[model samples]
Target: MALRACGFIIFRRLPPENIEFLLLQTSYGEHHWTPPKGHVDPGEDDLTTALRETQEEAGLGLEQLSVVDGFLQTLRYEVRGRSKDVLYWLAELRDPHTTVTLSPEHTAFRWAGLDQACALVQYSDIQETLREAHHFVLKRNE
Candidate 1:
């Protein structure tokens, strides 16, 4: 069975129509940067896992986010020779200035624009996902 994980492509809007996405740097492995996410626990639904992981990893609670409607992306990839599937839901941070508290799972955090976000994440699929999400937000607001 494919390993499943879920998370939010968390973004915050700035003045004059700028948007920045959040990326967390891992404490382990290659220390790749990614959106806050984690494995789905047994008996937990995907959305719950996403929310729980975001809170645990990034210290962002559901109340701090406005979950975007009609935007979801799934990426299938291999990790350590095993198939993995990740679901990402887009969410806008309710307050752009909200403080980010990082857990031990992440060594650092960054808020970057589309191009920078794409560059920070090493995976092509994640880069494409960030592009899609940026476009989705722009289109939805128009």
Candidate 2:
């Protein structure tokens, strides 16, 4: 069976400048940077899994964000030689200045621009995910 995960590609707007994306540094593994995400629990729907993981990993809830509808990305990869599938939906924080509370699963977090976020994410699949999310927001703003 495939390992299923879900998360939000959360971004914030910074006036007098540009949009910034949120990336978290894991405390484990390669200490890689990724958006808030976690494994799906049994019997949970994908959207519920996304929200729960966001809350557990980043302390953000549905009320704290505005889900940007019609934007979803799926990434397939191998984690430790096992197939993993991760789904990400776009969201905007209700307040651009909201603080992030990281769980033990993450060591640090940053709000970065597209270039920096893509660089920090490292993996090609994740980079594409960020790019897609960026375009989704840009298109919405247009």
Candidate 3:
């Protein structure tokens, strides 16, 4: 059985239509960069997991975010001989001024634009997801 997790591709708009994405650097395991996410608890739905993890990891609640519908991305990968499936939903930070408080699980946090976010992230799938999220936001704003 594959391990399943969920998270939000949270973004904020900068000046002149520029978009910046939120990423957390894990304190453990090579400090891998990813959007706020966590393993789904038994009997919990994916979106709930995403929201819960986002709040826990990023200190951003649903009130701070406007979840973008119809923009879910799933990426599957191998972790220590186990298959891991991660679901990511797109969300826009309603207030770009909202402060981010990191959890102990994360040593650092970044709000990076698409190119820097892609370069900072280690996984290709994550980088691709960030690109897709950028494209989606650009299309939605148009």
Q: Per model, how many backbone clashes are there?
A: 0, 0, 0
* Highest lDDT scorer: 1
Sort all candidates by TM-score, best to worst: 1, 3, 2
Instruction: Tell me which residue pairs clash in candidate 2.
Output: none
User: On residues 5-48, what C-alpha lDDT tens digit does candidate 2 reach at each position?
Assistant: 99999999989758899999999989999999889999999999
How high is the CA lDDT of each candidate model?
0.96, 0.93, 0.94
Worst 10 residues of 2 by lDDT: 13-22
Better of 1 and 2 by lDDT: 1
RMSD of each: 0.5, 0.8, 0.6
Candidate 1 overall lDDT versus native: 0.96
Say which prediction, candidate 2 or candidate 3, comes out ahead on lDDT: 3
Q: Which candidate is the best by TM-score?
A: 1
1 or 2, greater by TM-score:
1
Candidate 3 lDDT, 62-115, residue by residue in tens? 999999988999999999999999999999999999999999999999999999
